[model samples]
Target: MPQTIPKKKVRKPQKVGKAQKGKEEKMQPMPVYEKEKIPFRLRDKVAIITGGDSGIGRAIAIAFAKEGADVVICYEKDDVDAKITASEIEKNGRKYLLIGGDVSRENHCQKIIDRTIKTFGKIDVLINNAAVQTPQDELKKISAQQLTRTFEVNIFSQFYMSKAVEKYLKKGSSIINTTSVTAYRGSGHLLDYSATKGAILAFTRSLSSYFSEKGIRVNAVSPGPIWTPLIPTTFDAEEVATFGSNVPMKRAGQPVEVAYAYVFLASDDAAYITGQVIHPNGGEIVNG
Candidate 1:
């Protein structure tokens, strides 16, 4: 039989309501997840999580550490939050590295990998979780600066980090990217952010195919509205209060809830899974 060529999957754009993203900045109704008493499945593994100072990144950092991974936490600039997160990592009896800089810069990305290798001797897992969102009411409001900054921090960082760590990654090592439901369902307010997330989706799938030949796997998690600093940083008060209500679950998800998905994909349990997106968005389903 002749070998048949595989088909490339096409992505469809999703249209959503009109709302500005800054509406979520002032909200105080924080979402919570039940993560207590779970046994550490990632124990002793070495992983890197960008933006690990707070919210989803912080939750992932703690969860990964609990599962046995020494974590390298990279943040743009949050000294106090970073120190607190670092303190917790040490308290958990795990090694920790705090890297502060703009991940959008390739040189800084290289430095991150260098520091990780020097400190841990190897990189078993890489989680690209740092991102930014700017909700614009109108398409015209999405200035070139907004689009460029969004791509630089959100999509470009992934490229740099992946290239920087490619040589260090080996068989059984997995790469997890933090994509968003906005990529799947679209966000009226977060236009550029959604677009960059869509880029991440393509990047993850393509990278998975490239590396699967070597036993390295790549996957992603498309979280809906997990409470994070980004939410408070990007949206206003009332909007934050009603966050995640539109979903079938009728509420927002917590950072820890999303972290478990990362934990699963990073561990040996997901050895057979790659190039897939795990949705933990309070039951708001997307046809993936």
Candidate 2:
């Protein structure tokens, strides 16, 4: 059981920089929150999260561990980030498994599921949160190769991972897919990425209905803009500087902020919710 603690505060930093996690590590007065008290909601549940090395995936992994769920994180590469994430999970007194592979491949997805069950015995929550994006100013600038790659990582992997974990997921288990607000509002530069997010929304709704009788649930989280590795790696210095400023909140959300939605969706609190989406877009009002 997690011990009760006083609520913590996270003050915003005065300056930010590039280099992703390195910048986050140096951000003074970094985001903070109180840990959950005893009798964790996900107490003994096992969860699988792809793209778990950094950013939102990393945040969710830590959140799950805090709730007493063992975590298996799949990352394409980057042992440095994965190692830090593993250490944090261990700090929470939860077992951590790191799988280094490309989730875009069906065979790799199968291996992920097989390994998780082998290590943990059963799967209770599957978070399909891995994705990649490249910005193109014009439609003509997008090549067929880039389009295929984006789909494979962003949406295709969801299909493969879902199929791989479906048999092992028992009743009351939940699957949460990470879609983007761009799917609904559209992005002028992120053409392919937005398209795949739209597909994820439709897929989430369809799968929820398909699994309704099995007592399993499927849902999605759509985020507008959050400070993650993807932002620094995909955009220019100027674009990164002004990231998330246009939102109603006027700031990029921290991964921990968005991670709470996943916790709620995966817990019993959402037992009656499925085929729906939870938006954590910094107060942006988006129509379904």
| Strongest candidate by lDDT | 2
Number of clashes found in candidate 1: 15
- Per-candidate TM equals 0.86, 0.86
lDDT of 2 by residue, 178-265 (tens): 9999999999999999999999999999999999889999999998899999999999999999999999999999999989899999
Clashing pairs in 2: none
Q: Model 1 over residues 163-244: C-alpha lDDT tens digits?
A: 9999999999989999999999888989899999999999999999999989999999999988887777788898888988
Model 1 lDDT vs. the true structure? 0.89
The whole-model lDDT of each prediction reads 0.89, 0.93
lDDT of candidate model 2 versus the reference: 0.93
Point out where model 2 deviates above 4 Å: 1-38
| Number of backbone collisions per candidate | 15, 0
